[model samples]
Target: MAGNSDPLTPRAKIAVTAGKAVAAASRAAGRGSGSVIGGRVALKLDPDLLARLAQNLDVVLVSATNGKTTTTRLIAEALRAAGPVVSNALGANMPAGITSALAGGSEARYGVIEVDEKYLAGVARDTDPKCIALLNLSRDQLDRAAETRMLAENWREGLAGSKAVVVANADDPLVVWAASSSPNVVWVAAGQMWKDDAWSCPSCGGVMQRPGDDWFCGECGFRRPQPSWALSGDHVLDPHGSAWPIRLQLPGRANKANAASSAAVAAVFGVPPQVALERMYQVQAVAGRYDVVQFMDRDLRLLLAKNPAGWLETFSLIDPAPAPVILSVNARGADGTDTSWLWDVDYTRLTGHPIFVVGDRKLDLAVRLEVANQHFQVCENVDQAVQLCPPGRIEVIANYTAFQDLRRRVGN
Candidate 1:
């Protein structure tokens, strides 16, 4: 009821109303927000409302710079094997947004909410999580966030005294170092993509050595042992619950890491390994994050690429599949204020001719595509872009705003 005049409400009624209107318009044009209610924009939380939500619940809080959406969704899916589980099905990661999800899940016994790094401390302060999963830290939204070091330091400080079982990714030196600070930690490591991004110890800036998936500083000897939960494989294990001797339908090497992280959580929750693995293959991508939509009788694999890291992994997914692609970019603030990160993405995986570029900022992406020495076609609008592609199978790499636009273009 605190829609219009609620001063303390973080989101104004006008903003929420406009968001709803936009969502409605997008759906009418084709794309759905999944929930028929559309932008169910729930932000401002009264003290009474907050207190009510915190009454009695065991919450699993998953926070990360990247991968939380897919990982959290995977955890929820795996947990479902045991009993009814509730989560922010729409990837609402902020406190107010999570509050909305909790309000919606009236009957859920287990609550899984993916928390954004900036809001993790505030949300955790209010509701102590039963288990906290911390994924890797990477450079993302530099405009909104400080360097990864600063953000990781804050996470280290904020989570100092929490009782929640800390589940962390150990492959990343920063994440591994953070877990070392906590006594009760469930570390997850991957020797799968064990390529060295870190040369020296994070603590002393000295050369580090990896002796059997265990990284330690040569000078300071700062080390975090191998994770209790480890995933060893040639390729990052795909979570799509695979049948005997076969992987699931989703594509991407990063998704294997995603599934591994979720599998660790399932282990913590006492879900059988076989059951967890089964659920992972069955788990699908959250809407807009590698979601495949059947549009105009053509299949469009929508990969939401918001950051450099996401784009990098998504590029790998597109490499093996010999499908024509539509690389969409948008300059809207919601998508990103600066599209300069396009430089950081490795587009070498993309090998083909006349890649279609769609977006309000089609010219910008067209310029980049051209520089890559690849065939390029610029579309004034998304509808025309999708029209150019043959029906049945096509790939779309979209940023946030472009995702909505892309959905509508494909007649979502």
Candidate 2:
């Protein structure tokens, strides 16, 4: 908890108390972190708990297919240059989990929220955030989370009705279309590696004209906005063309882009660019992503990639050729039940790596790899997988639940 400037109503206080108690109990029982269950109980007791907790706090909502969690964490740290900040969600991101996070940090000056794409509209309506960062929209968890277009439409309608300043990616058509309806949008030239989902224009259903990283719609004439802020190599360029270097402890170009977007959002909060970037550089990992842990006498660097878009980025993060890379997956509800997304990834890009497959759905992944002619061994878990690989550092990339399973086992 941060402060006591705004007091909760009696009913809301009771809800918060009960929710924290339940969360603590759940943690003790090892059922999970209790973020979801505790917030669920709190909401059951007081339906207005979320709204009540959000009051008096400047909130920043971050939604994207791949980097929402990392972006949210980065935004929180960047805002800390202004004051005490509490992030809304990490692993838990729905209404319930968000409520729990708000309750836990009742008096923080800011709430940097990692919102699930499907729930962004409702969550945004509830929080009435000061700013919203609309990262790229792609086909993720399609079986349950709806298609990317539907989520875009939802965001379009929601942003059209809100007063929040939108910081959006200019490279993603779906995201651009969604944020276009907003009154105040700060477009940023954040790179988007996965272009599979943005082939058609959302405005007129015209075939999108994408030449290299540039894009346009021939029918409706909608195109990427002239970004006021853009990224040049490892530096972030402001509206005035002043470039600020971004130094992050996190790995990959994807993370550097995340830092750029976070700094843009923090600028709306009155934090200076250098201050924001410096604070963001302090963040080593988000949740368990990009975490390196010692396991079974081998260093396991954990990475998470659930969809084709995320996989494209993950492929670039691993060590160069012949490094042992373990790919794990699961069909649990947390991960969309269908394993069909496995076929969407260009597994041939990993041709030279010594790959291994694990998790409940390893066989499905093995079959996918077989078609691509990528050689890999099947192991029961990280322990067995690491035992077979040469001693030193090994990379592990897993889907949602499989990542969580290994993260929990490794004591993250």
TM-score of each: 0.81, 0.97
Judged by TM-score, which candidate is best? 2
Clash pairs, model 2 backbone: none
In candidate 2, how many clashes are counted? 0
lDDT of 2 at 49: 85
The TM-score of candidate 2 is 0.97
After superposition of all CA atoms, the RMSD between model 1 and the true structure is 6.4
lDDT of 1 by residue, 110-205 (tens): 678888887777777776677888887776676777677677777777888788788888777777766666668877764334233366566777
**Any idea what lDDT model 1 has?**
0.68
Per residue, candidate 2 scores C-alpha lDDT tens digits across 336-406 of 89889889999999999999999999999999999999999999887788889998999999999999999
- Separately for all candidates shown, the number of backbone clashes (residues 3 or more apart, or on different chains) is 9, 0
Highest lDDT model number: 2
